[model samples]
Target: MDGKTILPRSEVPEEFTWNLSDIFASDDKWNEELEALKAYPERMAAYAGKLGESAKTLLDWFTLSDEITVRVSKFVQYASCRSDQDVGNSFYQGMRSKAFSTAVALNSAGSFEASEIMAIPDETLARFYAEEPKLETYRRSIDKLRRRKAHILSPECEKILAAAGEISESPDRTFSMFHNADMRYPDVTDAKGEVHTLTDGTFVPMLMSADRTLRENAFKAYYKRAGEFRNTYASTLDAQFKQLKFFADARHYNSTLEASLDVTEVPVEVYTNLIDAVHGNLGKMYRYVELRKKILGVDELHMYDVYTPIVADADVEISFEEAKKTALEALAVLGKDYTDVLEEAFSNRWLDVYENTGKRGGAYCTGNGWPHPYVLLNHKDNLDSMFTLVHEMGHAMHTWHSCKYQPVNTAEYVIFVAEVASTCNEILLMRHLLGKTDDRKQRAYLINHFLDQFKGTLYRQTMFAEFELQMGKMAESGEALTADALSAKYLALNKLYFGDTMISDDEIALEWTRIPHFYYNYYVFQYATSFSAAVAIANRILREGESAVKDYKKFLSGGCSKEPVELLRDMGVDMRTPAPVNDALSLFGELIDELSALLG
Candidate 1:
């Protein structure tokens, strides 16, 4: 497949398609299960107020909830996979909508279960566990719910909140429809006079173009359209923020950030530490920008020029099969078991590979019930794509291990620790590639790639995180989150983060309009923190070999059984302290030095 041409979903080869039938053999079967799931609300409602009856009754309720969870998970996974394959497919779209509605219905009806369990005294719960030994299996989950007792509303209030679940997502849904479905960009002519349609999917690649004129044109053209709908985006964002505040206030949280991080028991200091550490190291970013300007031989560096490859002549083309082998070789440091999981992911058709018409852009690994974790990739045959292959494989393998080792209740890891596994794979892959090659040019290319990761994941994400914090604070403080206010704040942050090395274009201010993560309260900081954690873990694995590998495996398998920070600490990285962040930045400085030497 050519980079310029996207095949339709039906035209893609079967081998590249995920075996979704592993979950349900056919759509009819999916429909059957979906219909059966409708009765789950009634079944779950039957156990309401009965959780405190006895240990046997409590175990029965847990079993029933698990059964509903398994069935609903399968239904939602199948529908989501189908819809993602082609967003325009109405059948799958309806299926996805229905699945969501059913989930909300079940949640609304089952809201009493947690409140009732929370009503049980600690002594009584312990006695119940003693009376029915099987209840001990759910002790951790029960405790987790108990920890939220302070935030738990009355049963009626909980029911009302649960019923409003679908309504709460309106802003996000509206923005998604506007961003993906309605908005369109004009065609921009490249330096060669070839016209290309500017789209969300093609915008990044265009920015990464070596042709400065093309990158600038695409940047302006894409944002110019976004600028047109600035009010719409701002309104959507405003609504989202208001919703966050509503939930926070309703749950008695001091602030929205507190509400967001409280779910995972993450301390606010982790977020603050990332911003402070990155700000302290802004000189490194400024130096990188200076290097970019010097290497590209441009008198003035602009935001649009930031993404182009510094080692343009060293552009590496890696095919899918080649990527698979490279990822396996790189990850073999984790020993045979981890490598075997990667093998299963490839051989078992666990991935839906390649970009096709109407397919979702970007990549992710999603785990549902009992089926193998599924990975979605819009794979382009380039160095970045190869790294993405390994990155997503990292996630797939994490899901595989966690799902294999833990029960349904604790199988899903929290987002705070999720990126560690994926980013760790990426770091390991880069080290493996660098180790395997001594060619100065290739090494320089790899180092440049590594620096880009640091810039994008560590520095850039921290910048976004800071901007998000400010926005949330402003909203909480009654400041209007108008387009002007958001854009001005973002621009100021850009100036502070980039320093004087690059020109901060006014259009770059509109970047907040395009980031969907802003709608996700306090989520982007995890990328920065997770990348730092990965750097520490990967270095340990490379330096200490088997011992480090064992700990890393344990971190992956622990899932949500323990606090995320504690889990990372067990793997020898304490994100609470500034050590990991500083260590990662120090490594960045070393990479820059090596690249400088190689270039000379």
Candidate 2:
């Protein structure tokens, strides 16, 4: 008999979407991985008493751990792919859920060993390295663990942290289940009379509908559902903040934000300067919103109006194949290694490109160093999809470069440096296409695309960072953040950023409910600062060419070998200063002027 098919969506194509075979030769191989993974928990448990045997034993334990990690990743990735294709698939969900539990166990077990290893006298651990040549790589990894040695407490303390991990994850887990599984929107019918359900996936398309009324209805219908869950959502976020605060205090950090950046060694100034940089350029953002008013002839622009295409049917809709070509042409400056690998990705099915009935929303590039990066995209035949392709490809290419240069031990990078390469690709693609376009309409569209990128990535993200700070401060100061407080804060900042041109309202306040990033503990700021650096590096590379590329590659190849700050310094950026952000915002103002004049 054929293997049991348990996907929520039973109508899945015969071939797995995006070729799971590339990662593993067949489903049979996936089963083998599962069997191996089932046997790993006990195998990992065997390391429990063995870690303290000697320094060599600790090193060998780590090696065994890495091998197990590789196997776990293989198991998890395959199961995840099946689930992503159809989240309702019970079989894969069970496997995926088990994989997560296994992962948590593995993490706890490793941390237990790491704590013992750190407690070993520093001089003794050093002498072990002298005895064993192969132990040097663990030296850096151990040094990092050593940084937390003080923060770590007794084995009893670690076990407490480990056991609480499941409960602590309730907020994120609740949000995902509710947001993805429970929420549904009313059907929004467009002027062409095309009726579409206003889903999180389809919300953007409905908002971009040429019909203003459709956008309005879509917004109203979507947020009505959000309104129903407001109290539950508020409670969920409260739990999340409490968890963050508890962890921060436990770790001896002064604040949660600091605790967060301590992971990447990124400075908080890099974050604040991003908000300041965008604030200094508000006039340009207002000007673009004013242009929306003038061109669309709307009496008032609303929050829903942001994604409304300012340009008419003039958009260049390229198929996925053509978009891949455009990305290759635009990223040619990154050198042949980039171009060649991207070509392989295109030909070899490294990307899951289409949106089927039950695939995940949005786009992401994810993989481990052992294998190349895998990018998942919900491709629309539009410019945003093209930019998204460029964006995710930026991440994959960065992963590619980093994997080539750094060892698996340090291959994964901080999110602080994550979006720079991706956003730079967006800027580069815009430059390439805009330079070639003589048509004023197309030029304005391209300029609008670039301007909108600044608005969403830079200005909007800073607004989010500001709100995030406020909420964290509120929670920190023994204040309760109700739905009222959350919405009020979000709407206030929404008005602050849009200035007088846009109408920021009650529905807009519901914005807080829509953002999943707020739950990430000070993560949205990275998008703002990454764009700041991307703007600087993009301009520098366009203006100075090879020298800028050389510096950028140094940053790319540097990995976690250094803190993000020093690494950015090696790339010719000083995170302590506000100059790069100032320059980027100034560039935004210039682009707004160009777009406005082109429209006129």
Candidate 3:
């Protein structure tokens, strides 16, 4: 917000940047590593038809594979993080492309391992495990692969599929380029006639402004720019879903959802159960929407008005330094051990902390058990950015704990439960802030923020999940996903979810064109599902104290050591049933009642 303009990457202080050097000493070193890695595919391919030759032979391959995995993981993470730091940096862009290509080649070379392993008889494999005790390190991974024996294609077919990995990534990569690098927006002028720069990072903060004219102008302009390229986005999405369908069909799965869920051993029922639970609670959402409209005193509510705080006087700007302190204090409930690691994250520059020219919009956390986890953030001096900080740190801390506790092979957690830790962090921060205040306006403001979490994370994400499913089905039924067809379906979903409380503006229909998650086959549902689980977990942590914290920490360390659902179930939230979602919705209803009483 300094001067209301994004600084160039060179202008940003080094202290505020992430330390990618920890992954590679320099780009020359990275290139050196990259050059060496190009030879691995041939080396790995030489091991074909020999996986079942002996126990030690299998163990040797596993050891070499694990070593290469750690190296490749670091390569990809470093290149991508550098590229994301400034999407317009051509050097890092090419590095990222090469890293991905080498990764695919390596994967294609190892495609024979699965079929070869599955060819080993169950009894023979059990004996092999007994013969080589070190092989026990990979018992879970072996079991998981064997569990999918039916889906294991021939080595040649597996290689073919593996080779398609880069091509399948085209949609997401294209969208990222279009969104972060190529896309441009006109300057937005405020009610005071002050011209403010508009970018992806600024759009939401603009909507949160109290000035209605600014909010409306920003929203319409942003979407109008996106609308111009609607057909291109539609084609990319069509190709994405078709690619997903191709893989699902090849693997003998019934639908894209089944293929996606089966990878992490999640039940298809979990997805359906979320939609059903949210549908049952639509009345609560409608009430919230109605309450928001009443509080704003608007003749008619538009999508642009939805983000502005209903409590006007309580808007407060929080500095990044203050946000760090607040986050530490808020997370203190997790114990000294956890807070110590958090301090490390702050001090060691694990986070790239502000937006710069050509930086990728939004935020993410990525680490692969190398030195430590790294978080990318466009830090703003506002409540939402603080929440984003803690959310991503939640992911970073989860990565830290998992890497420390599990081996490289098992340390990586699946996407299913990835949001739980982050959401729990936000809930804890909300509790800490809410506990610190009792004034009517302040309490109402905090409550409204909490309500927005449910609306955004739980309701909106589920809406997206539903749209993803419907889109997938449309593709499967042989429908062309033209821009008009896609927009109509999206607009209808908006109408269904928002009900009669707000106008289904035409600009909002093009909203789908801007969402990067649509390219990620069925990735948004976890935000909703995990939010429900986090509510239960966060409530228990505060209510039960140390015992709950102990269980939660263990869950964080669990990585993919167990199935994701079982990890949460062991911690006492059963995602397999609707209980968690229903419980969270009940709490949402209660908060609405509280906000109503407080505002009254």
By lDDT, the best candidate is 3
Give the Å error, residue 427, model 3.
Answer: 0.4
Alpha-carbon local distance difference test for all models: 0.87, 0.77, 0.92
Residue-wise lDDT of candidate 1 within 1-600, one digit each (tens)? 634567878888899899999999999998898788887777887888889989999999888888888788878888888888887677887888888888889889899977898899878888998999988778878988899888999999999889888877778767766786567889998889988877777788889888888899999998899999998999998888888888889999998998899998898889998899999999898888888888888899999998888888888668889889989888998999888878987998989988777777678888653777899998877888888888888888888888888887888888899889999999999999899888989898889999999999999999999988988888899887899998899999999988898999999999988787787678899999999999999999999999999988888888788889999999989999999999999999888888888887
Give candidate 2 regions above 4 Å deviation.
1-16, 25-31, 38-55
Q: What does candidate 2's lDDT look like per residue over 1-600, in tens digits?
A: 011222334454433246667667876787776666666667667777566567688778778876876666666677667666655456766766766676666666655765777677877877888888788876767777777666776667776777666667778767766775567778887667777766677788667667887888898888888999899889888888889889888778878887788777777777776777677788888887898888878888887788977886677657777788899999888778768988887777777776655566678877554466788877777788899999999888888788778765666778888888898899999999998879999888888778889889888888989998888888789888899988888888988899898988578888788778877778888887888878778878889988888888777776677777777777777767888778788888888778778877
lDDT digits (tens) for residues 1-600 of candidate 3: 431447898888898899989999899999999889988887887789999999999998998898898899999999999999999999889989999998998999899998999999988999999999999999988988999988889999999999999999998999899899999999998999998888998999999999999999999999999988999889988999999998999988889999989999899999999999999999999999999999999999999998999997798888889899999999999999999999998998888989999999999999575788899999878898999999999999999999999987789999999999999999999999999998999999999999999999999999999999999998888887899999999999899889998888999999898889998789899999999999999999999999999999999999899999999998999999999999999999999999999988
Superior by TM-score: candidate 1 or candidate 2: 1
Q: List the residue pairs that clash in candidate 2.
A: none
Alpha-carbon error at 154 in model 2, in Å?
A: 2.1
Ranking the candidates on lDDT from highest down gives: 3, 1, 2
What lDDT score goes with residue 80 in model 3?
94
Give the Cα error of residue 250 in candidate 2, in Å.
Answer: 2.5
Better of 1 and 2 by lDDT: 1
Error of 2 at 61 (Å): 3.2
